[model samples]
Target: MHVTWGRNIGTTVQSEEDLYFSANSENWFDMSSLGAFDTYTSDNDWVSVEKMVPPVETDDMITTRDVSKLCEDISSLYLNEKFSDVILVLDGEKLHAHKAILARCEYLEALINDGSQHLQQSEIAITDVSPEAFKKLLKFIYTVSTITITSNVGLIVEVLELARQYCFKDLENATIQTLKSALNLKNICSTLNIANLYDLSDLKQACHTFVDQNALEIVTGDGFTDLSQKSVIQLLERDTLLVPEIEIFKSVSKCKLNDDDDNLVIGSVRLSWLTVEDIVSTVWPSKLVEDEKLLGAIVEIVEVKAKTSVCRAKKCMKNNHNWRKIDL
Candidate 1:
């Protein structure tokens, strides 16, 4: 806020900048620059505005405690169909709700009130979501709280999917955060798969970062093999993957043995980074030999080895360094 003091004598200006954007009008501003202090009054001869102080905040404490009971009462009314106007047929189970559910949820509002035939009957069918997960969603919508998602990865995944499908962005974000807390090496791949499939950008980044930072252990784990071909390709493509290229190729080979994927590219790996002996004895003579994609990589390795030999012959070269041996 830029506050400019007027130079004119006997002029007073009282002002309040709504920096916080609070609804209260009681903002106190000392206006001594205009004139000498006098009794506070709503007079214009001077900057006669009275100081406004916001009322005390006692209501918030009360409301926070009262909202739970209010939610329970409203939920009771909904279940008893006291004023319910709609029924959700979730996997053959009837769930009662008011028209407000449509108002609160985007997909429900679109499906129920946007000229669907089901609107007339006040009944909508949800065939994909399980009844229990649907119930958990309703509880959150009605109570303004999320169900416990800790150590309940499956339930969290289901709810997270529902949140995304229904366009509940706040709930989707909350579920993603919950999923982040639950993530570990064991379930990282599965969570990453869901994040990718559901297009959860933040969660996807989190999973990718976790795997990239722990690439060594992760690549050796069972979860790495369980990853979708797309996930594996993405992991391999990241320059941030810190595991040795040799281990990565081993894991990729294992994955290839179980499921044939044409999209798995080996170019991301600096094949030259593998020692020449290792390449000749292990990499080339083994599984890498049959793969056509590695043909160029194998050639690159040989070229690097030749360069290293020349550098060694030059003697001035430090450790016969081959620039191609460096991996990004």
Candidate 2:
């Protein structure tokens, strides 16, 4: 005979002949007369135990795979998505993988945030600059994105730093172009400071050239007094590449003289070698015309004054006396 139990729960038992029979109504079990059937220790218990082991182990393995896969997919997505957005046109193209790009962005952001924190902690409001402009900074970092400077002076400076950080050749060249174009007498001092800080030799040369070209104008302007002592000395020490034209010297002479009062004395004027001819022509135009002895004395005095750096020329000496005889 066969004995069945818990048909609704899919548990059953079979026996050819039962010496004794006992089974749970809710669960089924087969037993010999020698031992009692225990419903709690049957196939259902084994099934539950087996189920628990696999899920725990399976979950762990799945978690490991998902983490690794996530990392790879995210990296690939960034490379594929962000690379196409680089718009700067240059001779060489820079391509970056997603992982590296993200890392660079994070680093730059940290730098900016750290700088901001320093400014805030120091209570230096004026030094508080926005990192907003650095949005494109990261693209230049990992991918060495091509940079085109149309007009923004500040952006040019920023890009130069970015190039230096990433060792981007083409981006650095673009920055140099912008620096060259933006230089002028008014800003040359600031440009020089920036170049020195960043160790930009080419930028330093460009600034020097600008200052040299506009030496006279810069020295005479109100802005000259505002320059730092170091900047003034640097300007003075730079080699004069070319002399100023006669017309420029004439202008300088007119600037030194008092328009309303011819008798007024002007003090020492320092002129560069480039502008010496212009100065001589303006002060002694008559010397070029007359080889006469009287005119020679006046020319000699002018030459002496120019040489001594005591550029004051007297309109009229005591009793209308020509001091030319004094060997001045």
Candidate 3:
């Protein structure tokens, strides 16, 4: 019997004559026919397919295992996980604390040398700083270990705090040296105040000694006005040698003879032996020969009275003819 086949179907024989073509062959023929239908239709189908299908993205999975591996790699340098733990602990502390430990480490390294060769040769004793301290120091070096001076006075003082807490002698010495360089009368006052508060006997003594030695500069200038009365008194008391020049005399008579005013005069009768030459040189150039002769006579008479009375025997000085002065 004759049977109708779908359009574009390929010829295929079946067991029965009812249908000789297969639907698969007809479907393949239909798909090939669709390609020639229209470019727009093919484009539309592709566009719809693309919109229906979600975009694929590359996955960058950063898991805890990866982080742990990274940390393990870093910890390999020290060959210990405990060091990594210490680093994590250091990260949790204050940023300054971390920096201080680092600075201390650098200072220790410079002081001791690589592999502690210098430490061994010099035989210097190590204090509270141990292997753990070095680990903390490294954590600081890798993290933050810089101390910034925001205020003028707090810089060295804060360093001292760190040094004291960590028992770092080098750091303490560095702080003291910096303090010495920065010290002025005003700042020294603050340093002294801190020393008192902290009960730093050595620092207090150093400040006191510095102030005492530089008293002239610190106590007499415009800067001195800023100092308290107590500070001034303390400086003055300690620096007794800074007292104003004193006019010494064997007796009151010697002190009074050197009259403050003098245009020109031959040897004055009251001039002491110690100042006799000075009086002669100053007066000799201006005096007449007769006046010089008169001055010499007056000097002799005063000397005679001075020797007999010791400037206290009234009768001895009264009997001397030189005691009765003439206008000449």
Candidate 4:
């Protein structure tokens, strides 16, 4: 006799069999993965266990097979041009698609319905995006419910740009999330650049946080020299930047920017935070700053340090005054 249980729970073939107490009873085990039932052993009582059975389907439920078949049917129509009404000319290749499916994209809908040149022409030449990225866009249009995004960084970035250009909000969001998860020391700079270019505020903020947290490593890395002057300024101005002021100064000096931007980028560094010796030894020798500006910054650091020392001395004197001769 077969006894039914909840989905992913083991089934029973006999009545009143000793139920083994597996601490992992809630987890489903694939019996097929093991050669036989004798392969599984529990120190506790052995139950008449069988492999977990597929859940019984109800009218309200949708099965995985049904969803798979639906996606497959929809995907089969992708690039099938037999009844296609529009041809998207991307780069040097032509992609055939139906207007109804293309209409799902807000940008394409506006172009197809409103653009004078696009309204009647069956072929539209797209120059801004490559065919590979656009193919992902079409796949999403066809099977959004089941489409898998590529993990390749370059392709994902292309999709991000295409998604934003086409106003594919879901695809854009998914791409941003993927980028966030994919962030690392090597790609953080380029990823930040992409975020800034696309005005992806969420991803931009994540990159900023990552940069600030890994400031020393990021500033010392090779990518530091590739940052734009404006990006470097923005990074240096951040209050949470965890790198030493000397490193910030050194990295900003290495950025490939014009002389005019050098003044701006250098201004973002807290010159007063650098020690007098550091200014004379490192900053002064580097010649990143003019003699006049270097002198002023050095003087300012000296004054601040002197004042700090005075305050500490006074505090120490006051504490000494509070200590009275005590007799044991």
Winner by TM-score: 1
- Identify the superior model by lDDT, candidate 1 or candidate 4: 4
- Per-residue CA lDDT of model 3 for 1-328, tens digit only, reads 2212243333333222222222243222232333322343332232111011122334775668988887555434432333321222332331222222233455544644545454244233344433343443344334333333334566457556656666666556655655656677667766766666666667767877666555445434444444343333344333132322111111111221223211122122233322344334542443432455546744864665433211111211455542322111
lDDT of 2 by residue, 204-315 (tens): 7887767665656765654555444344445544345222333323333444233332122111112322223444555446232223432454465466554432221222
* Cα lDDT for residue 290, candidate 3: 49
Candidate whose lDDT is highest: 4
Q: Write the per-residue lDDT of candidate 4 for residues 1-328, one digit (tens) a residue.
A: 2223334246544322333323234554434343334534544433445545334437987778989998788678788877899888888788888888788899888877766688889998887676887888888888784234344678889888899888889888878888888888888888888887777889989999788667779988999888876567778766666566777788888888888998899888777777777787888888888888888877887766632211000112264563212111
TM-score of each: 0.67, 0.36, 0.29, 0.65
Q: Where is the poorest 10-residue window by lDDT in model 2?
A: 46-55
State each candidate's clash count. 5, 2, 2, 0
Q: Is candidate 1 or candidate 2 better by lDDT?
A: 1
**Model 1, span 1-328: residue lDDT tens:** 1233323324334433311122433343344433333443444434423333445667455665587787777666545576789888887778788777546777877777766476688787887886777777777676657557566688888887788778887778777888887788888989998887777788889998787556678987777777777777777766666566667766666664332463334444456556565565666776544455356656776776543211101112356752222232
Estimate every model's Cα lDDT from 0 to 1: 0.64, 0.44, 0.41, 0.72
Residue 33 error, candidate 3, Å: 99
In model 3, the Cα lDDT at residue 123 comes to 37
Query: Against the correct fold, how does model 2 do in TM-score?
Result: 0.36
Worst 10 residues of 3 by lDDT: 244-253
Error of 1 at 32 (Å): 13
Candidate number with the higher lDDT (3 or 4): 4
